[model samples]
Target: MRLNSLYSELQWLPRAPEDFAARLKAAIGSSETDVGRALQRLANYALDLNRLSKLASAIDKAKSGGRSLQPLQPFRLAVLSNSTIDMIVPAMVATAARHGIALEVIQPSYDQVAQEALAPDSRVNSSQPDAVLFALDYRALPLKLSPGDAEAASATVEGGIAYLQTLRDNIKSNTHALCVFQNFVPPAEALFGSLDRAVKGTLRSLIGEINRRLADFVTESGDVLLDVNALAETVGLAEWHDTQLWNLAKFPFAVEFIPLYADHVARTLAAVRGKSRKVLILDLDNTIWGGIIGDDGLEGIQIAQGDPVGEAHLSLQRFALELRQRGVVLAVSSKNDEGIAREPFQKHPEMLLKLDHIAVFQANWEDKATNIRAIAEELSLGLDAMVLVDDNPAERGLVRELLPQVAVPELPDDPSWYARTLAAAGYFEAVTIAQEDLKRAGYYQDNARRASLRSSAGGVEAYLASLEMTITFQPFDATGRSRIVQLINKSNQYNLTTRRYTEPQVIAAETDPEVFTLQVRLADTFGDSGMISAIICRLSQPGEWEIDTWLMSCRVLGRRVEHMVLREILEHARANGIRRLTGTYLPTERNALVKDHYAKLGFVKTGEDDSGASRWELRVEDAWPAAAPMKVVSHGFARPKETLSV
Candidate 1:
């Protein structure tokens, strides 16, 4: 965000240290097998191209030396564009380091978007990249100004999407790669003053129509869409486009904006790979409002309307509330008396954020680093899944040094820009939002109520019985496909194999005769937690079914949801004449929580691999005993005739 052209819209990653050159050298010379976190810490700084280029060089050296970037998942990306894409690849590779992705790029020849996608033997297809980015601009697209003919303008718009659709379809069919298409950025040159927006046949109108339609295409196809038009508009259209540079070097935009562009693209990649942050930890005192409630008292604080200083803080509250509504869990990390912190949220009439919006609230004199870790533990989330926003530089620096995994964005001095700066950070970039997602914060809050009930109940059986939980089981269907794919990628800590599946692959499993899929939802007396668990089992042999994926939301971890899920699995297996169920536990940095998952469910260990992946098997002859106390509702597949007795 420090770059003058793209300020106020991207993350204010920390500035480089005075000894950054030496640090970069040391990182490159590191003998450790994996230098991912070390390099990621460096890339999380506010770096210009010169520094980014040096980091890129160091990354290349590390790769050449046969080192690993373990924490960063390896991603093979193919970029198809009409402009000078070669110059942009290095920055992308370097910036992707910050997003926990080790990017392996395959760049076909410049302006080969059509040829590379269509040709069977093309390098783009042969690369078999995980994703294909169609980085086309307006000029590269089929758009023309008819100057007054609406039908001609409509034809141009229709033709533009058809062109992109053909390329997208061909690339996907050939490589099975998820298509990432960027909408066109129209030039600053408007044909008529202000009329360009309303009049058909104008270049502005034609480009707008295409971009709008293109967005719908990506949504329907379950692919990714990068709104370059919105990014350019935020940066100022005049500053975003460099006509002279395009004529000189065939550059799509100014070279200076490459770092910002790369950051956006890398974030999209991270979101697709399920690395997006989930929690927003906010500081209360001068951060959310004009004054501290602990000292200023309730009436002394400035948070109401008609006041300039007060409205600024209100803006941040409004923004945080909006993020919470979209599944970004909210937490409060404050150094104040607990009662004082609660007073503002409870008593302040103008506060947009109530106590209900927050999933965790840490109010104490302890250091923020400790409180942040506590919040993570309570939420059952990772430190890397959080972003801490504080008004005080000291608190920010303390968190940056102590909890390096927690993203500490640089805050501007002006309180008015707090919301805008956080908005620009894009730490919670999402490709899709589900109904379950919208109520995620409420789910965590409901978990707290369950905890309270458990504390007073004094026994596990009593607590379980008091909650009155019910779980519904249904086969994978079109209505639940989006949430299903999301939970598959996002539920890392509870996943057994940690395998990723694209939309098309999940669709294939829906009606596959040999495949079995289950989508489970849980509801208690307190509230309904949407789609808390999912399982996929594949036919391994005539009488054996292998559990390809078994994952659950940790919100229901201690509630015996696992036992209930296994019960449902047994019912389906028995109905299908499956005698054995095979389960695999592939170890990862985050999934150790589930290392003993299968073992706890009475699975016998069968095999172990060098990477710590262990396989287990369960033999089923008849109905398996249900271990949990909750009632289950199952609508079994018609072929096997599965049923659950109340």
Candidate 2:
């Protein structure tokens, strides 16, 4: 099949890796056009031995020929493993290149993961990786226990885990890089064969117990965990590892599965760097359901029960519902009457997703690309954080062309494959799921209420007054750390400096006398906006403070919250004898919203850094606003001894 038509007609099913690789190489090298899309299609192929081999070969050729492939964003990746991993580097580079991550890997000596991670001078720490991945294996554990020696086996497991934990703690203490912990997979052989299932001292039981502890550590430490055991099971354990390779080359896992493994690691890295998507814009007719909603009508659409086609659509709805439950914002952008489009969701008894589940619904004759832009604007999210799903290839193609930043995954022609396609894309992956996540949909719903209020108010100032909004500032407490870290990491558009911090680092900053950390929560008469902002300030001198980090949730923008926060910061600084405050605005592709932030707050432009980041300074004597625009409440360390009540 022709390359353009192959993708245009959705005929690019998962081919044998070699067949797909050869086709992709030709398609990629033949044209200087749509090279990204061609690679994306190739990446969708199910990973296996042949596929990894062919993919590596294709990537090697592309590199050798200096093909016009899209340039990858550079990322420093440090991999410390007990097993030999030099062979995995090419595959890691290849898979990451496909995903737009130019991975520069740092490999430590075999079995020296802990040593390398703990050494302050080691390359693992010196490279300053975006993240450090520990590729641990069962070989790292001493498993020579005889039957009935359960106590000894348990001790060995405890000691090994303790040593691993110590290494992780050292890394956390020494560096700011995120840690990706890959748990060990149980070796296939059991000392007691099938009886290992019943024996606590068996090799299988010991490994399973170790993994259980590893999972607990991951949760408690707030580190990213790669369940290699789960991946091994998914690919079948026997196929995932090779004993001969382990003995000959110290390659613990099957070489063929390196691509898949790299995919998972790269995904987490992308999410950490704020490249992960948030909103899912879905199409209606033949996309969410088996037929056109406008033509098929509410009762006629095959969305529920009994028939195969109906089941497919039902599964898609259920999948979308699940994503919504996990805090993914769902919106509709279809070419149909808004009323007609919402009828099925309103009237259908069997509909798994109702109208209220959607954060936004824009169903009209307007082109989808424009409507999607509207959705992002309304939701206060960047287009890069959206994933558009549509069954119609034309719609997908148009959106892809118009908004290259938005992830437009190609849906399968068959309805039966819709849910599977979306799941396999892994566009949405969050490190931590908190209560804040579950309540996110409600917060957006409240945004709609606020929008309604804005339209009705007499003017912007009148609207701000009528809302009875209150801004409360609190110290960085444990109760709010998860959401705070999440906001620090995921927040892009409204962030100043755009400095990402992990939970441990944030916690460390909280107790430091030189650092002042505050969490901002806002509430209007409508509802609570949750913890909406965070600020980290460092004492540069006895009387001078520097704004280390300041980020606010996009949902609370345009409410003069920034003014309120700045006002309170000045008040607190004055009270504590801090004479001047210095702040920097680091320009990232996503943080343009805050370019004029310091200037608007009356901060003087001090100078610009080599990287073009602007620096500003505000004197405590700078006149405070004559009157507060909104009520401000301060608590904990952020609270001042005296303040204006309103």
Candidate 3:
């Protein structure tokens, strides 16, 4: 969509009432489950910064008033900026609320980026934020446009990078926070017109160099990059840079773009928290083609290369295919006869997506919400991990009402904007793509076949043996660092501790003598399931080890992967001369599946609080065989010779 239409085309249902602020005020002092639907209904709208600020203010009141906001992840963020960001914090909180995060931003006094990041006792470090956002631009760094001085230009870029890197290193060392860097956005006032990009010493060229180098730095550090430069360019540099506002109060960009900027930042934080959407549920008919396939037979549907309407649908198909290739699970939830839905994929020439691309196909006449839930069940994922894109506003509205957790972005009357709208929504945000990620769609497809195999195998034991699964248990190493961190953050339902660890923290575990870590993988007759589990244990005393982190991807839930993983843990504990193993189940709205996790594995329950969180202890000497069908592949604690990069 055009920059002019950034806030225009989303017609998502259950729009905020005219008295939205009043409703938010009333929502305070109420339980989240009781007020959750109302909160989501209000948050569903494409609200401006002013409205968002009001909503955020109410949420803050509820938090301070001791009302519970369960199911919402709380994130403390330290914002180290060179400009005025006080006006932007509320919008950030509100947008993060839309993504199911209660964001608390810590902003120091104006232009204190250097001192706050460096001083150990600074306000930012005292809060111990999960993330530190370095919101610096060209003016915040040392950049001088010396004409005919290419050597000086190079020094300027290196110096700026060094300055930022020092801040990131200090913050990380002080508080163990992941750094988020914002690349500088060049001003629209180019002195040399198009040559600004070509000249080495020009401000535009300097910024170009900085942005490129910034990406490399972020990749190497395993931190995050907020490409404000790209955001500004997307909105047109003219619209992004407000000269008057900057001169007045040092606003980083135009106030109009604050809402969009906040939304992007929130989604990034959600991705880091493993809350980003995984599945894209698509509606057929005018959505993918010109007419209903049932009415217009396979030959009559208007999906062609030449026609404008057909081309629009084709664009969306291509985009979905690209997403699937990059690890997004694509599902079809159309209200059509299964045979009719299959007809186009089997026979249509211009169709870009085939049946093979879909991980789940629910073409029944059931309500869209029901079918969407069915899709989630079939894939072993949560409703929160899905985004429903439907052309019908009524369907979108109903889905929003019944399933507030699912993301439903409305499509306009025209079909062309469908891809743009969905792309701009940023539902399926990811920070890193692993080898397993590229094959996620294929893994779901394989899961369907495995489910079919289970039904005919007669008994659970027979089914487990027929697959011939192999469990690979290895300590965390360089090769699997990225995927291990991903599992630690994302796998909520099967996660025992529901702990989140940054890449640096994961790396730290590798060399720490007091800690032991494991990365688990499984492969069966069907396919390699990749690294599905990660565990970390810290030495609690002279003879005991406490489970600091334990999580598994839910995709392998019923296959007895956890049994095999526990077996490895017991073996390692025994080899290390450990006397006992302690495990705790910290309860959350999403982790009830694992409340009795330790109990299921034969540990004696020691205690539980009112909230049902429990602790368990297992004597390593009393451990027996885990007895799963999977063949074991033991790496035997092959620790890395050197620290691995993430």
Residues 482-521 of candidate 3 have per-residue lDDT tens digits of: 9998888888788877888888889999889999998988
Could you estimate the TM-score for every candidate?
Answer: 0.96, 0.86, 0.96
RMSD of 1: 2.0
Pairing residues by index, what is the TM-score of model 2? 0.86
**RMSD, every candidate, angstroms:** 2.0, 5.1, 3.3
- Estimate every model's Cα lDDT from 0 to 1: 0.87, 0.77, 0.84
Supply the TM-score for candidate 1: 0.96
Q: What ranking of all candidate models by TM-score puts the best one first?
A: 1, 3, 2
- From the highest lDDT down, the ranking of the candidates is 1, 3, 2
Write one digit per residue (lDDT tens) for candidate 1, span 1-646: 3444335234477778878889998877665754878898899987777787888888877877778877877888999999997768988888999898888889998899999999878999988998999999888887878968999999999999999999988898788688899998889988897999999989889988898999999999899999888888888888889999999989999877888888889999989888899999999988898888888999988898999989999999999999998989999999999988998899888988898888999999999999999999999998999999899999999999999889988987878888888888789999887899898888888888888888899899878888888888899998889899888878889999988876777888997999999999999899999898889999998999999999999999888899888888887788788999999999998899999999888899999999999999998863365667787787756744333333
lDDT of 2 by residue, 202-306 (tens): 777777878899889988877888877887876677777799999888997877667667777777777765567888888888888878877778878887789
State which candidate, 1 or 3, has the greater lDDT. 1
Question: How far is 545's C-alpha from truth in model 3 (Å)?
Answer: 1.7
How many residue-pair clashes does candidate 3 contain? 0
Candidate 2 clashes between residue pairs 3 or more apart in a chain or in different chains = none
